[model samples]
Target: MNSGMDPHSEISRNLRAVYQEVESEEIPAHFLDLLEQLDAAERSQSKKDTE
Candidate 1:
């Protein structure tokens, strides 16, 4: 544990590095449009639910 080489900590560091790399990438425009479409659909569904 003093060496900071515990398996759990190693796995966590590797996962954090992977997450940071993925987080830095740019999202495609089509994906953004799809997300917006999803948001609109959810809003429509919620409105229907309230009624």
Candidate 2:
């Protein structure tokens, strides 16, 4: 189970980190898409788990 902190906030923080790296041109385009997909999947799974 997830802990005390807000899941959306955690997701936002992780997305922010990815954005910072992408802004620096550190991550590739395909990798960025992959991460986005993964984030989407995680959110979907979390929703299912909550239900």
Candidate 2 lDDT at 13 equals 86
How does each model score on TM-score?
A: 0.50, 0.47
Which candidate leads in lDDT? 1
Flag clash pairs in model 2.
Answer: none
Q: Candidate 2 deviates by what RMSD?
A: 15.0
**Backbone N/Cα/C clashes per model:** 0, 0
Error of 1 at 3 (Å): 6.0
Taking all chains together, the TM-score of candidate 2 against the true structure is 0.47
lDDT of model 1 at position 37? 100
Give the runs in model 1 whose Cα sits over 4 Å from its true position: 1-25
